[model samples]
Target chain A: MSIKNFILFLFLTAILWVVTIFGQSNNPTLMSQWIFDAYNKKEQTAKKIKGKKVIVVAGSNALFGIDSKILSSYFKLPVVNDGVNAGIYLPLILEISKRIINKGDIVLAPLEPNMYSYNHKVGVQVIDYLFARKPLFFWDLSFKEQFYILWHIEFERIWKGYNYRGGSPLTAGFYGAFNIDQNGDQINTSLKFKNQGMFKDLERHHKNPEHYGAEFSTEALGWDYLEKFVSWCNKRDVKVIFVPATLMKHPSYFNDPIEKEFYDKKIIDEVKKRGWTFIGKPHNYMYDSSFYFNTNFHLTQKGKIMRTRQLIKDLKSSLKK
Target chain B: MLFNTYQFIFIFLIPTVIIYLSIPREFKIKFLILVSTIFYSLWSVEHLLILLSSIIINYFLARKLENSILNQRFLLFAIISLNLLPLIYYKYSLFLTFSESSPILPLAISFFTFQQIAFQFDIYKKKQQVKSFEEYLFFILFFPQLVAGPIVHYKELIPQTKEKNWGEYQKDYFNMGIILFSIGLFKKVVLADNLAPIANYAFANIETISNYDAWLGIFAYTFQIYFDFSGYSDMAIGLALFFGIKLPINFNSPYKARNIIEFWRNWHITLSNFLRDHIYIPLGGNRVTLPKQAINILITMAIGGIWHGSGWTFIIWGILHGLILIISHRFNWFKIPSPIAIFLTFFSVLLLWVIFRADNLSDALSYYTILFNFQAIPINIEFNEILLLSCSIIIFFLPNSLSISQYLKAKPKLHWYHSLFVAILFFIALKTLALAPAQTFVYFNF
Candidate 1:
């Protein structure tokens, strides 16, 4: 390169470095609400916690008000919400391994059965959880885990997931991402069950029924990483609950088995056999199919209220236990 | 990856440049081609199959036709058809099935297909020789120009493939890689994305829009499509130049054309040339009677219009342009000075573009009704966005490429520091894409 060109390259490189470092904080259009809410809460948690027992209800759409943000308000505890939009199994594992997930946090990590293949929802959310999470983060991952990350990036949309609409906001940017850190009284609303996105959700789910697994057993959810996740949680000293939130009140195509009946039953038996608190039910919070987001397993607004009410009511006794 | 993405600009382009700059002259073309293909195919491997098939069919057939005598012309038709099959499949299928449902994979199948068709023609006419399949395929799928194109010919790109020279590595790398990329990036991320909202809002709810909004939307889209398409072309050309290959320029301030004929020649010049050479001339050119020639122009443009997309609006767009071209050809309204003629041509094309950019025929009618109906709906001007929209219009009308092309030919004497200054400005412009997600080149779907 010419001396002039040399100067130019230097200038551009400098600009990029400066921007990435400073400008990433106020990034608008962080489309997935739960992920944004998590980032909001994570930033908040980083400010609040020293060595707090943060019981996180982390999963795709499982953060915000329903999990740590709201649950903390109910219990008067400080919990870190590692909730991300479409937060599946591997990313959660990677996040936990990276120390974005803290230890001694009573994990209500929802056993999302669909995160079998590492994929979709713009791997940036995955990157944000994995790499964007503050470090003290463990550095090592198994070859399969590392390969899954790369493989996920490569085959994310094509074979991995069913998100073809390309990051259209199916829920409000304000799906209750409010955080109240003022005084002892607190309020934050992140409803995982929202129903307003009925048409969009249905269209998307119909296009790619990611719920169905490669091997069929009448389960709509792709149980790719469920077993591994359960096993992973079993080893840790974390107080865990395997709560499978379903809008399906009974047997149906939309609300799958609590884990194929056999698998979910065995896992529940194992968790109980191991003395961990495992509280869940088959189609426990089931509603009409209309209550769920038109497609996939997300809940709509009205659905969120009903589901959240039922969940908080059910989990209240468990909290006391 | 999108030209706008941080991944492409930072992750992909930066490393590619470093690798491209370090490579030996002989290895550079192969190395760059391989990397560019991988980058291009990151979205899906299926596209590669389509690309490879087109190249294979074209390459072997070109070789066969070159050596054979019996039924050579027919053989040429078969070869061209085979190459175009995927282009037809991917590009036209959705349009063809607009009433029904159809599937689409992200691929710039038309561009490669059209380029190879050009190559096939060049071979048969003894204008260009049949080369190795690798060289032919590389020309067809030269990553920069692969999707949206200047529709490069084999003659220009083939020589670069054979000749391994790296004398201008730095100059080409910085200028093409950094400078051209920055310009293209600015056009896309900053301009097109900015214009997108206004254009989208206007088109979706055209009937509800004011006359001012309609006009603004019409012109905004005109600029948006130009910048979006031409920006992609520049990016493609820039990418090719990094590997020491030059591709043709596709746009030439099309808004400055004096007549529809000149406008087509200037705008999407390759497509115009293809229609004129393949469709127009073969149909009897201007060699027939005047009215017949006018009909020929109409038919040619209709096909060309439909070539842009499969929708009725595209068909109408072609017909409108075809009518304009015929009217211009017959009337001598273009006999005025270059500026006036250019003005007339651009205004007509811009009006036609309203149809081209519309969601459908009814949407086009609604937009045009709102645009020319003179009934002003209450205009809510997002002043900053409106200003950007108008600025894009002014810049779109600015004849940058012809001047740039001329300047390049002249090889003007310039201080090294001036080049340095341009590089800095380029970086500032390209900075806009820093936060933007990777957006596919708009024409890539075609």
Candidate 2:
């Protein structure tokens, strides 16, 4: 172990590290399956709805629950579902929504409670890494997040190599895959959910299950971004509507009914104060447990149709004024 | 600034090592003391005052004991009580009170206090030399072993301080240090962190844990703690070596031991040594009648357990181990097969860790109830269950960091192939670290 050998070892280590960092594909599609699925046909979804009068922006709740075609036919306006996964943060959701939103376009955005907390920043980056294809999207990540992505890519390349993959099977398992339809709604509902629980069991289980809501220390950054997005839309004469997330109407669903009431009122007041439209109360969108595909807001086909009909009725009455 | 962090390795360690190696020998100790103080103060500025106060107090007390001819016994008692004060207030305040909140325990309070207490006991018994304040501070605040420790002896460290030469970083020493650090970083990031999710999920939902999940949870924690502490010890030793100093090996593959006594010698060896020297022997050790010796063993181990954390679970864990050790000691008259002995020893230790990891006494009991109950449900553990099993099996056969270092040769005189292997090891460790957030070393809680 002479000085020369020690120096040589260090030199080799540095070279390897640099090479690994630079060797990654600039296109996230070439790196991970989750990222590829997210980016694939994403631009097509956005481009297809250009100049559309109405756009629905959200995460998995909108993707899984909204029936844009039904809404379009009823309102006689082209409606686009711009929802992806719930993992996307409010900032990127606003960024993506603005891309397709034009003058006089009505933007309906409902945020899932899970994405309202401080930890949601990581969730957003995870979604961006797995899906966002643009080079700019990668740069949007914090340095720590970028480092995490680079490290994971290198880890997979070196250790997992050909078998390198990342993602949760729950999303994939429910959607049959991560594919989205041309309308930008998740379509592969051939997911095999073993009905281990009957309706009563599901109801009992979901009863009082810990949920993300006002109790979650809200991220001020998310709310601030939302306000800015709304103000921007207002300047362009593009109407922005803040809508409540869909929920299962089970007694067990609202562990703190008073908290839910307070959260909804606070959210409505905040949205209205920003010169935007506030939709129905949080509990207005509640449906039976049988209507839900699985956890929280993801709706079955019948449930979606029922929800869409209710939303159309509510919108017609509200817009008439 | 955990050892596994990029900040510690690249920002703190690399720069410190470079600067230290470039400095004159006379200024090296001063630089290290300053750097160690900075590293510690990052955790909290208030805690720094606490650490410095403890150091100053112990320093004066040790010196006084050396100089005093009368009332030495009283001073010894006073010093021991004073040392225990901060540890008890910070660590056990909530347990002592019915209150929900407690003071934040200062990092390394348990470790340094124990080290200082042992130093005081040794000096009073005329077994140790009373050194200057500079040497004493170096012994206590050496950053590598500061937060979590092998419970370093003053004798072990004070001598090593003399061997370090400033501006003369030996190539062999630096290389060995790097190798050990990489191994440690890999174990913490990959093995311990990966296993954490499974253990955490099970523990958090203890009321719903099925038998299968319970066993998996306990098994995950067993390996999690082993690799976590083992990785930390290796990193500490390796970091110490960068300055041409060697640290005593803390772990010796305790899981491979065939009995409780052997397991202790292989596990946290320094603490076992301390307990033996300061507590067991002082309490008449095995020189007394069998019943008295048994009582002494129980008392020593129970104190050892409480030293780990302030909880009934820890006490129970210690009492269980003490009882098992007594049984093992008494039963050694009959020879057992190696495989059976290993399984028994490992299984007993694994069961005991459930108590160590559980939140409370009832939780530990519930875990055992579920574990022994054969009426088990088909609990689908939502984690990499296979990896947990595989890693646990691998621990039995793996050549630990110390043995791996030995195989590389004392000088670590590398052939081209050996150098390549070590380099690959370093890359894997770096890649793994990038995969997850830095996990605090498990023993840091102690």
Best by lDDT: 2
Q: Give me the displacement of residue B354 in model 2, in angstroms.
A: 2.3
- Chain B TM-score against the true chain B, candidate 2: 0.95
* lDDT of candidate 1 over A162-213, digit per residue (tens): 2323333234433434432321111332234334565665655555443323
Residue range A20-51, candidate 2, lDDT tens digits: 54544343432334423543455456566556
Predicted complexes: DockQ each: 0.08, 0.26
C-alpha-based local distance difference test score of model 1: 0.60
Model 1 alpha-carbon drift over 4 Å, by segment = A1-321, B21-26, B36-40, B81-106, B161-173, B206-212, B333-342, B377-380, B387-390, B393-436
